[model samples]
Target chain A: MESERSVVIAPEALDDLIGALRRRGFRVLGPTVRDGAIVYDELDSASELPIGVTDRQEPGSYRLEERDDEARFGYAVGPHSWKRFLFPPRITLWRAKAENGGRKIEEEPPNETQLAFIGVRSCELSAIAIQDRVFIGGKFVDRDYAARRDGAFLLAVNCGEPGANCFCASMDAGPRVRDPYDLALTEMLDGEHRFLVEVGSERGADVLAELPSVPASQSDVASALAVTNDAAARMTKAMPQVDLHALLAGSLEHPRWDDVASRCLSCTNCTLVCPTCFCSSVEDTSDLAGVETARERVWDSCFSLDYSYIHGGSIRASSRSRYRQWLTHKLGTWVDQFGTAGCVGCGRCITWCPVGIDITEEVAALSKQEEKSHAATA
Target chain B: MATATPSELHPVGAFVPLPFRVAERRQDTGDTWTLTLEPEESGFAVEPGQFAMVHVFGVGEVPISVSGPPERPGDPIVLTVRAVGAVSGAICASELGALLGLRGPCGNSWPIAEATAGDVVVVAGGIGLAPLRPVVLHTLAQRDSYGAVSVLYGARTPADLLYTDQLEEWRSTIAVDVTVDAAEPPWKGKVGVVPKLVATAEFRPEAVTAFVCGPEVMMHFTVQALRERGVPDERIMLSLERDMRCGIGLCGHCQLGPTLVCRDGPVYSQADVGALLGVREL
Candidate 1:
């Protein structure tokens, strides 16, 4: 069924697609080479993409190297996810001023940027969907996130290069593009540099109608499927097949938490790089005369000492407790809160952790301990 | 690229606070003050155990429980705040006629409606009495609707006790037993933890609905006392406190296990949060 809607476009026509989006008033953002990493940034043309670049990622490591062939979207995800754009780092919530011996409050205007994201990975799409539930699916919605997300265009790219740390297959989140995208592209690098683009929405069909392209051949569709299949086959890491929520719930008192705490740093690197972490804190700032004031929301992490602060002191003060909170919340209680796991298995948390603490490794240890306890009880 | 109409945007007034003028202010203690605020435009209706996000313009916002009876349109909203942090301190120092921002009546309310036929036991410690004040007032207004009603209250010292005059007034209608952790030589009353007083209170333990609120440690001990006295866990209601920023549950600061305390509860039965309370630093 997908083969009928799929079309083929040459490598040069990628620039035309960007032009069409920009002409339609979208601020196109895509992957680009910056500061020795492939980070998402504003792109005026396809020339700005990380051409001939591939990234090698492992726990506590990321390195960009040249690929043997020119595959534009060859690399797995980098440090930046689309979260920083949809849910910005800092935003003014409202402003207040002293007016005529009384206080007058003013709300910040709704965001109006129509974003067009390029090179979005499948795991990232799941992350976006998870955040959508967090922000908009609840009883109270975040109007700002809704504004940016509703008007944005998502261009998904099927994965052909799974990072060493990526375990999206185990989480059932990626390696193959899914719904909630405008257009899904599978970059084919065999013999000819072309793309098999499948239209996921009407807007995608409209854009494809404008671009110079041909209906995808059977061979082209097969090549695209083979690309994702090979990528999935190449994945080396996977989350152990167990009920993660029950595992963490039963293993809360396991001694592995203390062992992991000895090596875990509460540096908040994993949360910042994660695509679905949405915790935040707000700040109220005032002018010198104390007449004008504004409140701004900023990203916050559970690993921070002040994140769980009450009147007397921090709740999760110990490194063991903080790490336990992050892991348990992401893997265990998040399912209970949002009806899905908070983690996408994108491996950003693993690749960016300075201490090289791996989530899958920790879970495996906890699972082993749980089995031992059950064995003794039996 | 198309512009979204206003209708397409979800009405998100959750973060915006409504203006309320401080109509009356009374210092309950040296550190605690109760402010009765009249809404400038619309009314702020709240249930018994619900709370409000009170804002002092330039300082910050903090969640304070409504301490007065349920109000109608144009009625005043009441909040009792203690100067424990910078935001509460600013709210405590606000003068009369000062305009403050309020964003609540957020979170689930106590199951007062479900306790009609059952005896009600209200246990409060220190400033925790503020949130439970409405429950007492509501039960007293319809005095004949239930069996024996009791109020067990405790504070750090006599000087830290809130609503002293009302406590004396309520004694004539219901069993009001007050205790302090410590007192001077002149003070003659029960001088022990509030949980100890819970055992001596007169009520049918099997048929009583217990509402307990205080510091976490105090509430834990009170729950133990109630359980020991044969009160069921589901009937033991508790109001919990956590660091809250956005009272609407978006900020993710008030999570206790799977529940966002700001959204799912400021109030929960002992059966709901018992395991959560047992876990240290959860």
Candidate 2:
């Protein structure tokens, strides 16, 4: 509102920019090279970003590829994002020490750091929005997820280049953010040295005020648009969810599941890599002395036998049923249950799957079956 | 439409490791322990068939049925927990004064309101009786409020009947007909399964509501027994248990068809889950 929140920064402005954020005392969490993938971690400088580097991805495969040109964020999706900052994989629900016959209760603190999640992708924001529906908009709410989500600052990045596994364009979720972000940074790699930014929040405007910036001419904005368009058009994967809820709803006896089950490793890597998957199990443990104790909510997966157990037996006993449950919930019942598509089409599950079980390919197969069955009846 | 009203859903939760003064611990088997917890101050009188998510502090919580009657007001309720997971394993090792976290008395309970006038047959198997024990106790307390009542229970063996002393108490009053898959040398009661007993029992199905809880196999046969005896699906109730990680209903782990066992039920009419039974491995 004060003039503009937009602060156009060149590639060289990254280091000083990180220093400014650090001086302001924000624990800046952003992307960095880790184990052959871009992962979010504590960063102090632009050097942490994989400059002149990009990633190659596919179902069941992820590899690093050398970038022909240098750009901090010249690529699309990464394995890490704001999710880890908000919904931790494991968290302590209760802590207690010995007191007489019962354990005395202990407490956990709320977010201790002023978190600034940098380099958030548009699709990731969509995932976050979906998670909001799950954690904050239900009959019962999750206090911890709310605390982490509410006070944190966001810095979303529109896609400048599509990864081989990316299908956000097909899902109509990304490349350019339709909405939801404090500030959206559009990387203009075509420029000799720079990135163009658009601020979407008042907080973003104030943050931009302290950074060295100048008004971008119309050409800069136009070039930024071109880069995003190229990324959207170059996307390697495509998924159609048109009437997916109905398709899945009607697919109770779909035989394509048997095909998928035969190859699925039941490794749960897909759920682990997925940003929105949030099934968790509660754990309670005690010290041998019986003096202290704790309860924790750790991530759980449907692939595990223990995930579904009653006094008698597991309901979804077969791997086929487990797979069917997960697929149906993700694409079908989720809409009836949560009123939103459970997937963001970011394609992390594709690249991380060890057996290369592609959700897009699976949906396409199901859609194909629907057409075939319709033809058979007609 | 978010199933989980996240921020407010888990309204009061924080696993606090506290020494749960183990008021008592009864070893039900090599892998099962019936524990009675006394809330540090004055334990809440949880309803019949209600459960407490028992936490071993650090391990996590599991829904354990309260086996004791709530009429005593603040008296601790009994929990017959089999050592199937981490929490159960720790509770099996816990002694009096061991600390633990308590989450709730959640999920829909037995319809104590509707089971009036008509006779009620409470059938349970193995540790499944723990969840049904409260209903049994409440029925006995207000004996005049309901009609003729009876309890039929079975277990893997003679020793598996949880709360044996309580079984004797109910038996001494009327009949706590206990059965087993296979009777032992010392076995004295009926040497058959629960559903078999139901088939031969003298209860009138037309004037009764049979609440059955057991291994799906046992319940499967029991449902058949009631149906053959002319009991309508609506008159027969069952406790449908599944993997209920987040009892608040956000996690899709326990969804069965259009219902979530965590929220819509741990209790359901036969008609509610019959479609699920039709699907293989549902």
Candidate 3:
């Protein structure tokens, strides 16, 4: 099955693959150059892919740089993730209308658009799986998320060129596409621009049978493995290997929180760009004459002052507390809630933050604080 | 892909509200109101500490405890709300026969069934009495099952007290002690905080299962009083309040430490959440 599953295709064959998906009633979505940054958008052809593109990312900064070769999927993740497609930023939950004597309530039907997500990174796959735990894996399923997830097709791309902030190697989430993807692609640029395609599922095999492809030679598979291995080696940032949950649980009063709060804007950029941050709030609005009403679920951040609002006031009124809540929940308490860490080491939180508060750096600081406190007690 | 069946598409998975009509409405105080709601189709039975997400049509929803007696499932669902926010204000203003939306009977309930043959101490502060009202009533209904039962209630003032008539009537069967933070003329009961009343409550600390609900500070002091009285941490229970959008626990607003207060608890033993309560602004 290993030899039968591996195949190689020319760069142009990507067009036929997209065409095949579209013919099968899937709206193909992939990375494209949008507003000077690579973003996921509807794709009609493979030419729309971000070819000859790479990204340079640092804390609080992101920029698109021209690559020396035309290799698609040559960049780390951007601000936009597949979360926007799965758990939309805003969706109508239900609608209500004033009827005779009583109100008539109607729930919004589950979204049924079949989506073929192309170029899904390994970390992004982990993010999706984490959200799957959050929405559908719990006692109550988010029907919308379940429907969208059940019908979607995943086309994972193994990372070949990791960015400055890439740390999926440390989080054990990626650089290699080992998650449950329909088809995994590794772009090779040794003399010829081609993709080594590995069929990950029966559906992936069916799709490959329709496309013009050949069995992958020993060299082809080796080169593909080397691409991801090189990316792992190129990673510069990493989360320190420690019991992060205990570190955070003991550092609730650590002054490092105040330090981050001073630099933190509480702008919610990290949460908004986060692929697995699932916090949301519901809003109810009515039309004029108070006849028709709709309830909308919108993406909400814990950093927002009102996110923790109760009857009297917001429980976490201070910026320090709110920042602490976001970080502690993402890296610490998230494991207890969903059996996994919320952060997938995607680095979007660090790259997109306005103040450039690097989560990795903060955790390192917290670790150092923990060591210092232990030494003092000793 | 297969489409969802009718049962799979049920509103329970989508957080959709079921229609309920306000069968009875009574203003408990100047700002608080107790509403009895009847389901238009099927009714939901709730345990003593369980709560419901009461919705006011165009207005949003808020988590309110089931204030009605748990023994009376045939009776309409009772919710006592204070006009503190927009949603609660709309619920408080709901008139009799007004249609509203409801979801849940969510979160864990008080362990009254487990406290049989032991004393029970029910403590409430201000509007906090609404959630614990069921515990006191449940104890009264099964009077012989428990050794001793007491209800210690406190409010900002006599004007802010809820269920005044019910408090006097409950005195006939159980020990009901009411206190005020401060009082004006004609006020003639205890004049200290509610935790002080815990000292004179008629319950043996060794055999007592204490249920407490109130403002965070008040609950903190009350739990301290219970601890000083030798009540085991596991036996002291409290209901928590937090911002919640989905009462089913997906919204993540009601998270306290590792627990989603909406799912893991609105009611928790002191031994479970004591350290978290001590964390400032947690």
Candidate 4:
């Protein structure tokens, strides 16, 4: 690998980077204000980015408002992540039509289109890596996810302001980017509005050659580092430092599960917002004439009672079992299965939860029970 | 390791089903039938205890175990399906010469090699016997290699029993015993749960490696009976049933605790999964 290089670019020149990527046949996708919050979509220029906008996020709450300072990428993550683009919500697996003497099965090819994602946060990058373990890291890779992932280019943005519900620092994922990216930009607005760009790959260097930028000075790098450090200190929530995998696994019958289950609506909002949740179910539908059939895979959540259904009845009958399964699987057994924790600590699940149920609080409750049990033994 | 073998495991991109012709169909019970399928093209290989995702044209796909012996040069793959649900009912209703789609031989199987030098015991209840048919045939074919072979089968009633001729034929070489839960007159056999037959079966607890397939409740009781008789947990094997969506680890439908019953197992030793089975609503 080549040594890293840095550059200084004014806020207006950011459009030139977008133009360079578009010239190279990349459909650049960036965050834009939509439906009361910033969501990712196709972007033609930097004007489409959520500039001068910040989000107010808390447990079971998310709202966007205007900001006095015009800082690009000022907000934390929204409800959606990049998973929607890689692993689509619904995919057509195959189609079968009644042929001459027998029905012929036809396979549907995967979407191998090229894409470039802009303004990816550190937590989102960790989420993508976790999903890669589930879909692409195994012996049998998911062809659709692998193709899309292999063809895409990532543009990371280091966070300067951690949102109210953000806890990526505790998860060891956030406030700063660590994953491999084509290019990384840290927006520094301390008296001077300029971005400290770090070229992470050869592709990033090639694109940097096309843009008009000056070599960043040592002070510029210091300013960028300070911005991320302040953001980490400002994080409102902190995940408890405990052996989460062991604690949750042993707390299967803990009473705190019942308390949270009563408040949970099982609407699946938390799973839908979670960047790493990848459970899906297949649906086979026939045409009105009943000559052709289509098999499709669609996203499904564990909160649904039918997700674990068998022939006679559903395996997880109560909301209590379902919630317990989700939390334990995401935080506990996931480490054993995938060699990593499922949650990226993006706090999207907390902000998007309708009933304000916080995973951090639930984990803390379980940890407290364990401490009491240990004390009794002592 | 009930997970698929390297050769039989297909990447997700190969989700397309292949058309196979139903060469023969035999009805064993009112709601159950055994269908023998010949793939339109050759080169299809399926291992014993493995299953296939069988698709009926307009209905849907359901995971059915390959009931036949390991594929021979020109033999067909056999599947014993019972009409327990809508998808299975449609599959059982298909006529001969009809074409159905198949996509598997996925998941792991019973360890036949381990039983070669030791006592081989097989327990099948109701339709669960379909998956274990291969193990029985394989052990009997190499009867001289194993110490002793015993097959204990049970069904709801005498009429509900499957493979009558095969059972009688197997008795000539292997120890085959049949029982019914509620039998009607003239029929004189044991009338109790399937695990009770384990007491009368000829095998030493130290040398026996049992293979079981049945309802979850029956497997639980049978495993208990085996453990009480001093059979180690690792030597006792059983196949589990769940709502398997994707016959791979991608879909989370068939997960039981830390194990993905599709990829990690449908077959597991009692020592490996005894604690997992104890967890409620897992």
Tell me, by DockQ, which candidate is best: 1
Candidate 2 lDDT by residue in tens digits, A151-218: 46677888987888888888778878865676777888674667777888776766766677787767
A1-378: candidate 1 lDDT, tens digit per residue: 389889999988889999988988889999999999999999999999999999999899999999988889999999999999988889999999998987888888777668999999999999999999899889988888887887688999999999999999999998997858999999998868999999988888888788999999999999999999999999999999899999988877789999999998899999999999999999999999989999989999998999999988988889898888889989988888888899888999999999889999999999998899899999
**lDDT (Cα) of model 4:** 0.86
Interface root-mean-square deviation, each candidate: 1.8, 5.4, 2.2, 6.7
* Docking quality category of candidate 4 according to DockQ thresholds: acceptable
Candidates 1 onward: DockQ, in order:
0.63, 0.32, 0.62, 0.41
Winner on DockQ between 2 and 4 is 4
Q: Quality of candidate 1's docking, in CAPRI categories?
A: medium
lDDT of 4 by residue, A138-224 (tens): 876887777667747789999997888899999999889998888889999898899988888788888888888888888888899
- Per-residue CA lDDT of model 4 for B74-120, tens digit only, reads 46889999998888998898888988888776788888887778998
Q: What's the lDDT of the predicted structure labeled candidate 2?
A: 0.75
Encode model 3's per-residue lDDT on A1-378: one tens digit a residue: 265579999989999999989998898999999998999999999999999999999888999999998888888999899999999999999899988988888888776668899999999999999999999898888988887787689998898888887788889999887779899899999868888998888888888888898889999988998898888988999999989999888889999999999998889999999999999999999888778999999999999999999877899999999999999999999999889999889999999998889999999999998899899999
lDDT of 2 at A311: 53
Candidate 2: Cα lDDT at A7:
54
lDDT of 2 by residue, B71-99 (tens): 55466767888887766788778887665
Error of 1 at A19 (Å): 1.1
TM-score for chain A as predicted in candidate 4: 0.97
- Runs of candidate 1 with Cα error greater than 4 angstroms are B1-3, B6-8
RMSD of 2: 4.6
